[model samples]
Target: MDAPVSTSPRPWSPPPDASDVVKSIHAMLHPRNIVVVGATDKPGNYAERIWNNLIKYGYEGGLFPVNAKRESVWGVPCYKDFASLPEPPDHVLVLVPARLAVQVIRDAAASGARSATIVTSGFSELQDEESQRLAAELQQAVRETGLAVTGPNCLGNLSAGEKLFTNIDDRAVTMVQGPVAIAGQSGAIVMAIRQTLEDRGVGIGYMVTTGNEAGLETTDLMNYFVVDPSIRVIVVYLEGVRNTKAFRDACKAARAAGKPVIALKLGASEGGRAAAMAHTGALAGSIETFDAIATREGVIRVQNLDQLIETTECFVHAVTPKGNRLAAVTLSGGKRGLLIDAFDAVGLNFAPPSPGISAELGAMLGPGSIVGNPLDAGFAAVVDPTVYMRAIKLMIDDPDTDIVIIDAELPKAPHELRERNLRRVNDMAGEASKPVIYVSAMSIGFTDYTKELRQTLPHVTVLQGLDRAVTAIKSLIDYAALPKQVPDVASSSKPSARATLEKILKQAEGAALDEVDSKKLLKAYGIPISKEAIAQSAIEAIKIAKSIGFPVVAKVVSPDILHKSDIGGVMLNLTTPAAVGKAFADITARVKKLKGKPKLEGILIAKQVNADLELVIGASLDAEMGPVVLFGSGGLDIELMKDVALAGAPLNEADARALIGRTKAGVKIKGYRGKPALHEASAVKALVGLSNLISDAGQRIASIDINPFLINPKTGVAVDALIVLNNEAARQSFDKSTKGKSTKKGGGH
Candidate 1:
């Protein structure tokens, strides 16, 4: 079952000491000896396949198989249990029924096994009471015995460098060791990624499937890979993260070591989240929060398997580009057009050729070429292959180009023309100062000859399909352009400011604060709010409206009525006292006629402020990620537009500005069409204030919404505000206080 979301503060704690986790994970991945607990030679048995794989892969360590029913299997002795073994193994593979898996782990631990992989299912993933009890017992076993465990519902792991293969998949037999390490929550995804990388000539150094992650999580594997010397890039396929802080730290460590980390994360859509929950019993957090974390930590996120494979290939083989500028040369005009379209779709543009370079290409290609960003070399290059190399050289030499691409293909079999042309392009790429990549017109599998060509030109980066190649290029450039420093959370608020907010919260009675009280909270944080006041009667409302200004806005103030305008409780452009009085009477009468008699808390009379644009800025406590701030287009159609951006809060100035820039409201605020630019600095200040407010007292405040925050050229003002308190937290606080008072009275007696 999914864990309940908490309203209290869930402060992120630092991960366990790095050296300790790394040491434990290293032992699990590179065990000295392995024992198969449920090993048998019965047909279609998982343990039998795993036992064969260990022997087939040439594992040099000791391998002991245990089964009470079998005397001997495959010329190896089968023991009854862990107690009967001659010596304790360092690792144990448990492939028994769910009811017996916990006992097997206990036996393995008692026999001095340091780690184990539980391949049995029926744990928390089953989401039944019995399954949960088993899961709890397994967790207790690991904690009591200090045993490093991999999974209770997962395939086993593999260490390519050590020739240790414990996985049950058939594809594990052919995985070649390389510099890339793969860690995933799903076993099938791990094998699929491993196959794709190896098929594309990218070797895999390590593969780990952290199914259910009963004891060891994907973050543990990530920490290990970051410190390992042989690994250069880390690939992760995750349904959800167990520890947010540890995950961030691992990504940061990889970035510091100059190793790229690519993630293919699920749970962006509702169905995907449901599937993840059913598959692994993981509570998938919001995708926006994950994206914010990924961006902050400099991790590359891919949308699909193709993008993951293609992006990984580029990072492994190609040099990082200095900028987004690109230049390409193609032999066919149609291919060039497709390249342009692909690049444009991803918001990338090719570097326009310099006049000198364009003229030189025009003269050299006999005026048949239309030279631009993606220069087409024309059909003449088909006869005279030197044209391809010379054009590539000029494009690479151009001052504006940061990376160069050339459309070409490797021959499936030895052909004189194709081989000669490919060789020339390879030699040029070898010497070019800028990064150069080879692109095929369409996606194709590698033939034996293609593999041979790749071996010869190990430095050349080859990408298939125009769309996938361009997407990968964008990832490469974006990764290269990331800032070196991760922005820290905005500084804490002053003690006086925090104390004032706390006092207001303690005095509030209901779950939600009315607009007047909400504005009071905003004003304490230095956020500009509309000039408003609450009036108990129509005469008082008219008196306040006249004092504020001639034209004013009157809104009903009630904790029960969140959407006041929907109940005809809001009156705008009240030009006189008569109008304000009538609005107050109308709003109260409408509330009285409602099906449920909601308690009316008078009306608010505020000055009407003209705005150039309407925007929403708010902050709330995320169950997993803590405080998060949201900004988007506001007004009644806020839900319909759905154009917004979210980021984990306590945001610095730069983060706040970047969050705004991600939304469409940011574009309109920057003088869209003939509109003059509004006060964006004011908006940034408000967002930063809201972020800091939530971070300071997020335990008490459930959410703070400032919708339709009207902005003009001069400043921005919060026209409507709503603050929802964490009702659970308030009750807990009250209970604690009452208990303390009762204890003191009893002591006095």
Candidate 2:
């Protein structure tokens, strides 16, 4: 019989809906022909192991070996180089030194090979100038030749779908082919996860290690997995992603395809971030940014390896609970207490047995048996084991039960009895709409037969520990409840506002806009600001303060100073003209004493705002995810606690309302602990306006900082404003302001 031919076209030969780059990646992952570069007769070498694994795994493709010093390698005829091959192979595994890897890729490209896996290191991971230079060279070769490369320092990939195994581990040759596709930056993690999954009998379809990611990133593989018919879930062990746009696109694609992506991303902690940077040369982005994107994209994030495996095992049952309500049944009363505590800690709700159901259980057990959520069946289960099944069946059939969890000390029981009990439970679960997860409370002491029972069982999950079980259960519920709406990330609108903002940004100077001009920009977006004026001297400051009214606020205006109060640059409650005049002189004198001798624009005199609460609202552009909005407690504590909530910008009022509600600061705004309830809607409106500002001037604006935006029941007033512009925008604004300007001041808000 002849080997089957791949329907997939060659690299650079794209289908109608795909591009050449995507076609190239597809061929690399699922190739029909492969040639081993640097193939040798030496036993246990990387090339020898890969070549033998291909044959052992029953790879149905043309295999050619390239070895300059040998005529034959491992009983296969060896060619001298790519020029000597009979035909162009679909992919090549280049096991050469890092310095020579680029040349090998160029040779492969010239020979018409679509892809090459450069199994070499000493590139970007070193975090030095020379390594980075080499990495850049590799990237240039890939871009110039249009060849898809997996790594310059990586463990090769394995495609069980094609019976292709090139990873260092020969065990991959025998792993079962299934729906899960795993991709990562660390080769060890990729192989470890595969082994863990395979140990539990969960087969994998594709496993790829994107070391250094100079040419291909994890996102690229995710995008491909989204469309692959053989995959139902995508798992990734990520340090970080340099290409955030690609990550977002791939996540969205997976969501659209109804494939869930499970990510175990590192870099949430300082130590983890350092380790990740050292290991993969990944500049870990803000953890908050990663979390926000994950939430918006419906990607499931787990903390550790244990959760990864357990959650995946649970997903294999493929049951999506309708709600978080859980019905738990345990054989031991002590175990019931532990289970209840674990569930409560993670916010899983309990479904208490109805009165009639409780009464029935009471009569059946006769007495001393509690019939409630975490139901502790009577000691009758010890003598009559049928009682366990009966109690569990009743709970499973409850109308309020979205999930059923059973905890049992199976290791203490005879294997025969435990297997019988579990099999009956499995049968019951298989027929129900909700998923059933069994908690092995004493998993450490479990018999081998019991462990085997868990591994080999169909549609049955035996989670090891109580805490992990609760988390898995909660994650299952959260995934089921993920909102279906596509995320709206700053859709372009407000053409008039965009034009005005662009003009203003184009005319600004230095890094920041002074208070007067910042207020002018905010007013354009409909945010209310106190009437104010910039006064050039003491007499001018007195006159402006009087016009604003008595008890006005005076702040020193400068392009350099960020925190006015810290530098004694602010004076509040200036009731008299003399006090206003004195405050202006005092601010100027203090600012002059500060280091760097900041250029003071003028004294900004504004009517003091009286409000029920103070709030801080800010907007900034994230390098990875574009615009982001921040809301937090205002006043001096803003920096102390840093208690803030964040959301991607260009949001509507409803989204803004949800965003503000996420923080402790928002709690106080809504009348927490005997405090009067301030109008929260006013703040929401201000946030929406800020979002508009970001969307309108995103290219020109770097950040917008508004602290202590006074808020009352009906309105929010910007007490102060500071807008930072990008360099080009700042330079443009500086040129405009410096040319033929007398006072270096703008009109009032």
Candidate 3:
């Protein structure tokens, strides 16, 4: 097949007219005739091998060699060049230097050679001026000729069963003619997996290494094979997907075709995945997002290539283990039973073989051998080898068994004993057409022999990590019995910004958000709070306190000072006007003494709040997900515990309500210790509203602080509040501030 030479600019891309190039090159991979460009008397040239492998593998199709410098290299008469070929061979495999390879491709395209494989590199990797020129010019050539590109820095492709073989070290290309097609960036992984597949006698339809993915990228290959009837399983090994539309569409197409696509995309860690994601924002599709998409789209996303293979092995064998329910029949009852317990811990079901089968089993085994669920045939199988066969047939007869797991352990009498039994049951199960899982306890004891057996029973998957087997079971069950939707209850539309106050302080300039600024943002978002006042002096503070009644708090307002105690900026517990005067005097003197601290705007007094308990609700934007609401045990424990769950912004209010349900404060508020239910629903609703508001503000929110959100059975109010605006502070940062100093926690010296 012709490999494409990149012609894109600094960040290489396929030519403008690359579709036809890709199609034609794709066609050449399965060509009837191949013409070798630069065919010579060289012992191991790429072109020579192309011709030899084509013939060596019994490709009865036509072979044409085009060379400007040699004559009769492979016995078939060689032509001077492509122009001299009998009829412009189907594909021209060009083995030339980087400078000359581009023209050779153009000549091949013009001479009717559908595609050209430029098996030369030094194009973009070198970062040299000429290589860049060559890469761009080559890409232009594709636009000029509509020629498809495989790679300029790639190992090329191989489809062994179709006789499309090339020794490009794409590295260990195996001739497995199965139903899976693999697309990979790492030729080494592709090679390793191909070998593993071939070892299992599995066949492959297409294998491509899209290194750098210049043109005719991974998705093009995916899109093409998705429609191909012969391919039913698609495996992708990726550093990343450059085009989301193409990648998604290809996956959709595969699903539409009932093809199972197993992907091992590595990103989300290390520089490679990050680089892959950052360059294209391909979503490197983080694990959570990827799993969600794959589940929704019917794509099986695996972690590494090994899991990719293991998952594929199950699909290829058509082993659809639907339910977690498992029934094991092993040679050793103890070993299989132990495995069953392990499976249980992993959330796997151990379904007992039905009664009728047990009776039928009674006749097969002597009166002594116990034959029930987890039919302990392992010990009995030793006494009677044929007993294994009887147990298997009876187990399959039971309607209760969805998957029959065979735990064959004890060493046999050795006449190719395990193989014989395996063949018998394998053939039986093949005819039965039911899912059968195998775990060789005997093989587990021996590494070499175990590997050997695995090679033979390639259809049987050897699940990794006992934990992994459970995970696999759970995933499969979930797939079969997945729910349509996860319910979301709208909890609140209030801004959950209280914890964000610190962020605001950092960006604070000379002026701070006044109570009006703080309350405006909160009020606009619908968070309920007390009515209040911002009086400046002792007399004014005393009058406001008397009106709000005896128990109001007073504090000096200032953007300059944070800890009100250090500066005597706050005065609390003002039951009498005389007490208020003395508190007011203390705040005024302290403010006059502090540097870089704002003078007291006034002593504000308002209705003081007394609630059952104080709960802190806040919002913080995560590095990935923008804004998140966190609710947990409040007070000093907040920092110590960090026992908080984060939920995305624009949160469902019901989700907010649910968030409280997840916290310890919820139990207290919901009537623990006979405590009446606070306005719990109202508080949660407020938090949810805050989360949405902050999310909408996005970068505009620098921080917010609504500490000690007082909650009682009947009502909840934020006693203290602060709002940090963005680079440019929001004018309405405190719309949710107290109506007045109906608060405590005042500044004090």
The lDDT per prediction is 0.78, 0.75, 0.60
Could you say which candidate leads in lDDT? 1
Between candidates 1 and 2, the one scoring higher on lDDT is 1
Instruction: Determine the C-alpha RMSD for candidate 2 after optimal superposition of all C-alphas.
Output: 7.6
Using TM-score as the measure, name the better of candidate 1 and candidate 3: 1
Candidate 3: tens digits of C-alpha lDDT, residues 78-166: 78876766554665565678888788877777777665555567676566799889888877886687766665655556755556665
Candidate 2 pairs with clashing backbones: 507-733, 508-733, 508-734, 509-734
- When 2 and 3 are scored with TM-score, the better candidate is 2
lDDT of 2 at 110: 90
**Candidate ordering by TM-score (highest first):** 1, 2, 3
Tens digit of lDDT per residue, candidate 2, span 1-749?
A: 22233343422233568755577778897776888888877778888888878778877777888878888877767888988877676698988777877888888889888888877788877767988788899999988878888887788888886778887776644456788899988888888888877766577989998887778888888888877777888899877656667787788778777677888877532211111211010122356656766657768888899888877767766477888888888777888888888888987667777777677777777667667788887487887778888888888888777888888644433567777877888888889889888886643444545445665457566676677767777777777777755665564345665666777777777667778778877877767788789999999999998777989989989877756887988999899999999999999899989876888889899899888777888776555556667787776666676767777678887788888888887887888888787878768767888888976774566577778888876667889877876565344544454567442111000
- Clash count per candidate: 0, 4, 70
- TM-score attained by model 3: 0.63
Candidates 2 and 3, the one with greater lDDT: 2
Error of 3 at 585 (Å): 17
- Candidate 2, residue 445: Cα displacement in angstroms equals 8.7
Give me the runs in candidate 2 sitting further than 4 Å from their true place. 1-22, 127-130, 170-174, 268-285, 409-414, 441-451, 487-493, 673-676, 726-749
